[model samples]
Target chain A: AQSVTQPDIHITVSEGASLELRCNYSYGATPYLFWYVQSPGQGLQLLLKYFSGDTLVQGIKGFEAEFKRSQSSFNLRKPSVHWSDAAEYFCAVGPLMDSSYKLIFGSGTRLLVRP
Target chain B: DAGVTQSPTHLIKTRGQQVTLRCSPKSGHDTVSWYQQALGQGPQFIFQYYEEEERQRGNFPDRFSGHQFPNYSSELNVNALLLGDSALYLCASSLWGQTSLDTQYFGPGTRLTVL
Candidate 1:
C-alpha cells in the first residue's frame, strides 16, 4: 500500500524567511507525488506534482518541490514566507498505472507565518 | 472556467438521518471522486465515478453510496449517519486516463455536522 508521511504537525516561520516542509512516501514502484494546500473553510488547491521528468517542480503561489527518488521524498519549499501563505499542507502519493488513482495523504502540516 | 462546485455548503443533521451531497464537475471532466476530511486530518478517498458507473472505491462501508448522472454530475449518499461522519465532503473532478498522473481539481467542500 502507498502512504505519505509529513513529519511536521505544525511549523511556524517568520515572514520573509525560507520555508521547507518535509514529506516522505512509501510505495512499491515509482510513485506519483503531489502537494496540496487547504485554507480554512476552503477547498484544497494543487500546489505541484512529480511524475516523471525533472525532480524539481514549480507550482503556483511561489511554491516549489523537489522529488528525491533515492530518499523517497518530495519536499515542498518556498524562498520566502508570507502571512498569506499560512495554510494546511498535505503530501499525497498515487500509483502510476490506473486512471482511478486514489491519493494517500499525510496527516498534514499546518503552517503559521508570523509577521 | 468555473471550477468544480458542491452544493449545500453547510448542513446539520441528526444522528441516524440520511444526507445527500451533490457535485458538478468542471467543464470537460468526465470523472468525479469523493473525499471526506475530518477536522484536523487529511482527506480520505471515498470513491470515484466514471461514465455513470463506480470505477473505484475506498475502504468505506456500503452505507456510503453514490451516483453519477448523464451530465457528469454526481451525488454522495450516506445513510444512518454517525457523529464520526461529520466532516467536510469534498468533490474532485478529473479526466480519467490510463496512467495515474491525472490531475484532480477539487471543489469547496460541503461541511456536514451530525448532531
Candidate 2:
C-alpha cells in the first residue's frame, strides 16, 4: 500500500539553528511529493511540492526539500529556525489516478523552537 | 482570489449522532477533497469529489459520505458517529485537468468533539 513515513514525532531546535525533517514514502511509481505546515488551530499551508524534473524544490518561508528517488525520501530543510516556524509539518505523497488524485500523508512531525 | 473556506470552526456531538461539514473551494478550483485529522496525526484522505460526482475515496466506511455542488462547493457527512470519529475535518480544493498537476489548498478545519 502507498504510505508516507515521518519518523520524527517531535523535534527541538534552537533559534537560528539549521533544521532538517526527514520523510520517506512507499509508492509504485514516481510519486508527487508535498510538504505542508500547520499552525495550531489553523489551516495547512503548502510549503513545497515535487512533481517532476527538479529534485530540489524551494518552498515558502525559506524552506526546501530534496526528493531522493532511490532512498524514497523527501526531506525538508531550513537554513535557520525562527520561533514562528514552530509548527506541525507533514509529508504527503499523491499518485494520480484516472479521475482523481488524493494525498497519502505521513503521521507528521512537530517542531519546537527554543529561544 | 479567496481561499478555501469551511464552516463551524468547532463542533461537539454525541455518539450515534450525525454531522455535516461544509467546504467552499478556492477560486477556479474544480475538485474538493475531505480529510480527517486526528490529534497528533496527519490528515487522512476521506474522499474527493469532482463535477458533482464521487471521483475517488479512501478506506473510509459507508458511514462517511460526501457531495459536491455545481458551484464547486462540497459537504462531508458522517453517520452513526463514534468517539473515534472525533477529529479535525479538513477541506482541500484543487484543479485536476489532463495537463495540470494537483496542488491542493486547505481550509481552516472543523474541530469535532465526540462525547
Model 2 over residues B1-115: C-alpha lDDT tens digits? 8999999899999999999999999999999999999998899999999899998888999999999999999999999999999999999998876314556799999999999
Model 2 TM-score on chain A: 0.96
Clashing pairs in 2: none
Best by DockQ: 1
lDDT string, candidate 2, A32-111, tens digits: 88899999999999999888898999999999999999999999999999999999999999876645568899999999
Inter-residue clash pairs, candidate 1? none
User: Which window of 10 residues has the lowest lDDT sum in candidate 2 chain A?
Assistant: A94-103
Every candidate's DockQ is 0.66, 0.63
Docking level for model 1:
medium
* Clash count, one per candidate: 0, 0
**What is the lDDT of every predicted structure here?**
0.92, 0.92
* Predicted structure 2: lDDT: 0.92
